[model samples]
Target: CPPKIITKSATYVYKLSFTALYTVYDVTNDHHMPIRLKDSSNSQKTRLQYASWVGDTNALAMVVENDIYLRQSPSSEEDYRLTFTGEENTLYNGVPDWLYQEEIFKTFEAIWISLDGTYLMFASFNDSKVGQMNFPWFSSNTVLTSDKQNDRFFFPASRQIRYPTAGSHNPEVKLWMAKLSNFSNIEIVELTQPAVILGRNMQKKHQ
Candidate 1:
């Protein structure tokens, strides 16, 4: 997407649906100042993050619906789907999972486009084995929307997030590097180092 123009004079940011007028599936020409595009598919959040033009390059990358999309240039009619493992509340690409977001990366996204835009490095987290933690939230409601006949009163609500505990299965982290030449190619590097165990265990893996 083209960089958004900031109007410092009457500074205000607003969310509007651009898909109504122009669609990525329909457009071809890139106008001056480039137009920012959005994912046409309806999503739970309907929002994207970690969007930026590759450092000193014409390519663009963004996280939409927990999946990463890349384009050779801003003028590209459609973006290439770099990852397909992203599932709703499950697998994520270029973005950290719940545990990593909370305790690991301590940041929103876990992706880095190279300074020269020749390569991209990212972290992939597998939290399928991790357990979920739910916090109780008391709410007073006459009828729960999900329940019919208004039979339920004072429904219990809770917030659930994946959190690892002692002796629990920690999220397995993996690193991957992708080169621009082969857009679909991704190589995984296993950094299986038992740094905590200061002896033969660490040496064995390195060897």
Candidate 2:
């Protein structure tokens, strides 16, 4: 079967003029409509980064500017903040830090929803002890003439991100799970050694 495309606003909503309109669209049937999400009172509502839909429904697990937000249902408007320690370069929530991105996971996101859609497991990386790396990036589009010798016109911008190399400090990684009903912290994943958990089985015990 081929996928249907929305060519006009009559078929699908192309634009909307409203503040705090987080919409969810379902296109399984005809006359696809958008469900507007309710907004939270959190003053810092930035753009979403790692937005993921849970199971086969409209449940949304999203990351906005590194913090995790959960919406249990499509018609619900309350956004749940699962983790609160999401500083730019210091701490990460539901996502891997720079060290895990470079050394372990090799990706930005470090989260996975359970198969039954009742739980979510995500890794938290605390890089407060790790060092930093800095570099300069020159824009390829900006034209730099050799005739002009002024250092100010060079526009060499400094780029910085936490980079852990070799045997220095690594990110303190820990896994956490939260229930879907109230988004409560259920269990903490830990390993005193490899291939072992410090507590009871997360699957059987938490359920």
lDDT of each: 0.60, 0.60
Question: What is the lDDT for 163 in model 1?
Answer: 79
Which regions of candidate 1 are displaced past 4 Å? 1-46, 137-156, 182-207
Candidate 2, residues 1-207, lDDT tens digits: the string is: 222222122211112211222334444544443332246334433344465676554677776546787776655656677777798778888766666765667666778887666778887888888888987766652336763555336566676767777888877887776667455443444424343453445656878
> How far out, in Å, is residue 26 in model 2?
2.5
**lDDT tens readout by residue for model 1, 1-207:** 434312112211112111111112312344333324434543322235456666677777766656777776756676777777776455667878776776657676778878888877777777778888887655455457777465766547776656789999987777777677655554444445466775777678899
Give the TM-score of each candidate: 0.63, 0.65
Q: How does residue 185 of candidate 2 score in lDDT? A: 44
Our tally of clashes for model 2 stands at 1
